[model samples]
Target: MLWRAISEELPGPKWAGLFAEYWPFYRKWWLKEGEPARPTYAECRRALKAHMPDLIPLYEDLCDQAGGGDLAARFLSFYCPPPYLSGCSQAVWGGKEPVMVRNYDYNTNAFDSLVLHTGWKGRRVMGTSDGLFGLVDGVNDAGLSISLTFGGRRVVGVGFGVPLILRYVLQTCETAEQAGEILARVPTHMSYNVTVLDRKRKYLTALMAPDRPAIITKAAVATNHQENVEWISHARFTATVERERYLLQRLRFHRDPEEKFINTFLKPPLYSHQFNAGFGTLYTAVYRPRKREMEHRWPGTVWHQKLDAFEEGSRNVLMPGIVA
Candidate 1:
């Protein structure tokens, strides 16, 4: 069962074309409806192709294997733009970033289990064309984990950006540190807070951008804004003050390692518009992948609810089984 669960199932050629078709609409929303000077499809494609040549071919191959083209057109009719504020700004017990946490149960050699909550949008591609967007959270085969938080800023530039960054981390890196290294060198067009967890369950790191150097701060907490890193502030001091305040408040609670924090936050009445609207935790997810040999709190029920919301808002099919 474990082997089957982790097995790699590639997609066909038609699926790859579907993914290509979806990019334009996905970019339209991400760049905010009619803002000019946004990166062109050719430019974004070029950047992705240049930086991740190996993965692009693999992605194409996966799409081809999964059967591509018309499947994407058929699904394209269902594609819905993701809502702007559809992300969470909550805590993860024993988490390193705002919405990411992992547990290593030494007693059971369980390796690891993780929970990743996200905002903005994320996608899952099998071969290429038939991929589904809006995945905000996922755990990797390596047991490393990741989640995203929003980062707003006045200053902007032109370069490889956020969605690609998320894809890069999930597709290539196997640990928090490796993801950090990738962020250190990549050029980003905007600011974002990316949190990563490693396989050993030993470290969590957040990488914020718009500056050359990266800060490796030690904390079990993070949120949708920037933290008070002196160098980061020195470079763009005035712009991120409000974001800093949010970050400070999120740090008030020391994450409790045993609590299944995200799950607790996502239950019932709390999962609806009242809580999500009031607190700005638009969506949440908790993924535990270690029960094959061990046990921990399971939030499958809560995640399914959030998944439904994501599907309704985006008009994209939810591929829960892919992640499962």
Candidate 2:
């Protein structure tokens, strides 16, 4: 079902090829385990099968189109991991739903918001069917807010994959606690830190791994590295720590209407800070789900750019209701 959706909506052969390439990397990390017999790939697959069986055929179709050899190579490249860092900011405002903004900058330019939607059952089962789907940062009709950062060094074997996790969080969970419970129970393949905010704007939680979870009593923030977790230290994040600090400071001092906050500050024309290293900011985005009915503002609105094209220091003010 998920692959079918991709075949129906995306450019066929190219998308299928991409999916095949990434599948082995995904399977290797999630299925093969070492010391701690964490979550098994079989278990994760079963969970999706039981919860979202409709997507299996879709993935199979995509794999068949991609062939086997090319798919294997892509998997190897993905699992190797790269030394890159990404920084972003998200904000929620208006109505019961949450809005969001993010800056995705990396050494190698390979980012894409493949698709967007409002369903989870179809997605949870499909996993990373083709490319990433839905809003990497978004709010559901239920008014919950969610966003992510690659675990980088900390990511171990894969459990519930990132794309699937995002889809499940948006589709099934309604509050930060519920989202945390899902994160806590699942055996994760990679090391990722997810921040989930609820509708009332009263509660916020940051789930760092399968075992550690923390509550954010005040305004919350997350960078590429884990926060409040002991196994890692802030020092290890030296490469991108400044970027994270600048974002936190900006959010702390940010003063303006929600739209203005996103447009004037978050959207860019960013001032160079001492902490910034490597290619500044690739692209900045502000998404107010409630304000724009879950549509992404900026690049989607102004330049009609693909997410992979985002570069450091790129800035644009997006109009309302535009989508790729």
Candidate 3:
């Protein structure tokens, strides 16, 4: 997989200028053929401003900086409703001191996606997808890691997107409980399976949506749907059953997970080969909160990044035999 990585914080205007090149393509792709239809930029902004009023100034600054006179909607693109259907498989291993590993799958046509090693003022954060504003999965300097998958449904409502909520948890919370508390408070426009992990071996999974109450699940691995799959009649992804089963079987086989064992996801079941749309396995994130380290992985090779010191730029990651 090819990905662009950004380090320094580019002011709002500067990022707007850089983002100009990719705007036209995404702006036209508001609704793909089979995707869950989303609201217009105006509708999305109205919901976001009403729910997360604090982000308005930041959104305005970015649009104002982009230098395009009629670009308020352009900057608001960050909060636009994302694909209501995406695949992700995440698991927390290590009996004594758990580790969080995840594979994020999505439609490539929907986003001008990239990895971001943000230059936040208070906490150090590294996120996958969206260079500056939002995040799909990420780990913070405080040893808290979080990731999300679409909650197999087609309901959109008055709430914030899961990415920014993930960003907020990383920015403010240090413990898994704290992260969970914040997640409990926010309402999401769509459904998502969000998991948060901390060094204390505390891993929390929240099955959330704007229309329904959040269901807390007592499990290590979280796929695309809620814990109770019997209630799922409208999920977009049908492969969740196989994906969840494969990972659980692997875990049972490997009682004590080591570095080599955790790396198996670079292959099948967890790592995806289908790249036609955006559902291909973009990157497998292996987060070791206790060690304060993370691996940006490919098929055969991996880049090691630490909370204190990290490599901050774009690079190709490849591991020969692992690219299945």
Candidate 4:
């Protein structure tokens, strides 16, 4: 995977170039069910205005950058687009440094492999980019960090994609409490568990679903499944139960130092290598919200960045067969 980090204060040529590059794949996927099967441009715009009012201006700006076409505009809205799923594991480390970490497991061919640092709307936000503007996980200048995992459900409904919701959280919220409220209120088209951590070490995991109200929990660990494993085949395929139990054991039975705890994710069931299954661990991300520092780790390689001084660069990581 080629991971590129680009810093842009606003939507411009850089973002436009990304849209130009990825739009082909996105357009094909968005229209997999045909154009009429998706929401109309008017409906998409209305959904954004109603749910993520603060994002309208930015959305429009990006739409213009994406050529201002009706199809591009609706796609950028990310409102009830196609249904997607991934396997991930995330948790808050209460030991020290206000850290949150996770391994993003998903289809290698379908990822953007980009890290975006932007000062949009006067807030400095940086993280893994998805759908050009949406974020899979990221942190804001306000010392707030957020990440997500598949909620282990197969139901899809009328709501925004979780990536856009993650973008909205970092763009507007400054603390875990504030993030929880936004996670609960926003409607997700599928099931996803979003975890937020603040500078003060306060954290919560919101199990967001379209078929039901979001459940806010103080639990520190979140894997693929929610309260109970709803999709048995998916749960077993992803090893969601086993992974969750392993993380909980690490947090409860061990007194691992900060470095040791982080390393644990680099090994064993946490560091998955099932790319062919479309849920391999692409990268492990570690976030220190208080310090505004984040690291993308791939076996022996580690690239660190901070909000105070984010640099634009790129690295090619060999996945599925990484040497630790």
Candidate 5:
């Protein structure tokens, strides 16, 4: 259970090589014994091509470069699975550059692959995926930063996963309005809350789901559920209520500089180690899109990188585990 920092350019062999190395291990976790991941891949591929045609070529190139019969299937897993992540995200702008903080919470044993990918075609994305094709939380070179929180639910449908949709936004969008347009158009497999920050010091939180259309709001925090929708996963959704309150509390009343508010995510409520097993906070990310920079902080260390000149290297951070 560790996080790795990796970087590569697309249409290059190095990026494909990285994909080959982790695809096997990630495939094992994404498609367990007697799972329906294959069918999910089919739906995912179709949806990707239909909504985001730009991805089809990139995906095909990745598979061809990897030279694996199941490469596409492996790649699709990152974008087709059930929405099984929990976390907190908030965008703050108070007479300064916007700062977006996100803490990714997911199963430590379940595809625990975390990577901060830089020097990509258009954006620098960091996520718990095998490669740089998708994003869990990332900031683009165009000064648009985004983070996702699972909209607590169980209903799975035919739609693009939120991460891939985020990928789409980073690839083609540069403003909060454009990012919101993309988030609104793409249907998600389940539900997600995407918090976006732009260079213009504008911020927005979009609640997206397959059952309903995307909803935009001016709220600073993007948690698992919203005020209008009744979440399917009641128990998990119940927990989000407090986390949402905690994030909004910081945004509204905590009158401080950007770093101070961002640091709050590294503490309780926003950060947690799952005692019951499954998902937990992998790491906390703070992105300053205007600076074209991002900081990833774990327990004791922090890694900083810029979108234009990212340090190409890999460092491992120990993983979290459960106790009896």
Candidate 6:
């Protein structure tokens, strides 16, 4: 798989090029159930204005850059987009430095595999990009970092996608407390567990769902599911319960060093190689909110990015179990 680190201060030719490259696949997925199945552009715009008014200008900018098309505008809104799911495990390491480590497990074919560094609307944000503008996991200049995991449930409802919610949080909020407010306020189309860590070492996990009010917890680790395992089949398939138990034990019982703690995610129970099953560990990310730095790690290789001096580059990763 190919991964890229792109630096663009704003939405411009670089972003437009990305749109042109990924639009075909996105358009097909957006219309998978036919155009009538999705909401109208009006509803999408309304939701964006209601929940994330601060991002409207940026959204419009990206929409125009995407050829000013109606479908592109609606897609960029990230409001009530088609329901998608991924297997992930994230946690806040409350050791010496405030760090957030996570393994993003998802279909390699469906993933963006892009790390975008942007200073848009005066906020410097860097992280894995999703849906063109949305973020899967990222850190802002304000010393706040966030990541998400699928809440093991099958319910899908009316709300914005969680990636956009993460993007909105990093764009506007500076602390975990502020992020909790937005996470609780924003309605999510599907259930997800979003964990936020600030430079001050404060962290919280918000269990958000469309059908229920968001539940805020001071939990350090978040695997799939919320509170309890609601989706038995999914839980078993993703080993959510096992993974959660393993992480909880590590955090509560074992006093592991910083490097040891981060390294655990690259091994069993966390690192996964079931690519043929559509959910493999694409990459493990470690974020140091206080330092404003992040690392993308595979088995042995690592790519680093820092807010102070960001670099644009690319790497070709050989997927596990694939003969090169």
Candidate with top TM-score is 6
- Expressed as tens digits, the lDDT of each residue in 10-40 for candidate 6 is 8999999999999999999888988987889
**Model 6 TM-score (2 dp):** 0.99
Alpha-carbon runs more than 4 Å astray in model 2: 1-85, 91-98, 118-130, 133-135, 151-158, 210-219, 228-241, 251-254, 264-282, 291-324
> Which candidate wins on lDDT?
6
lDDT of 1 by residue, 183-218 (tens): 666655555566665545544545556554445644
Which lDDT tens digits does candidate 5 get at residues 50-148?
788776766676667767455455555355564455554455555467777787776555543545554455445544352346778777777888888
Q: Indicate the residue-level lDDT of 271 in model 4.
A: 87
lDDT of 5 at 275: 34
What alpha-carbon RMSD in Å does predicted model 1 have with respect to the real structure? 11.4
Alpha-carbon deviation at 79 in model 6, angstroms: 1.0
TM per candidate comes to 0.55, 0.56, 0.82, 0.98, 0.86, 0.99
Q: Give the TM-score of candidate 5.
A: 0.86
RMSD of each: 11.4, 8.8, 4.0, 1.6, 3.0, 1.0
The pairs that clash in candidate 3 are 13-65, 106-278, 106-279, 107-278, 108-278, 300-319, 301-319
lDDT of 6 at 120: 93
- Which pairs clash (backbone N, Cα, C closer than 3 Å) in model 6? 152-225
lDDT of 4: 0.92
What is the number of residue pairs that collide in model 1? 24
lDDT of 6 at 321: 52
lDDT, candidate 1, equals: 0.38
Model 3 scores worst on lDDT over the 10 consecutive residues at 27-36
Each prediction's total of clashing residue pairs, residues at least 3 apart in sequence or on different chains, is 24, 16, 7, 0, 4, 1
Alpha carbon lDDT of each predicted model: 0.38, 0.43, 0.69, 0.92, 0.69, 0.93
Segments in model 5 whose C-alpha atoms lie over 4 Å from true places: 33-37, 40-45, 68-83, 93-95, 111-113, 116-132, 228-238, 318-324
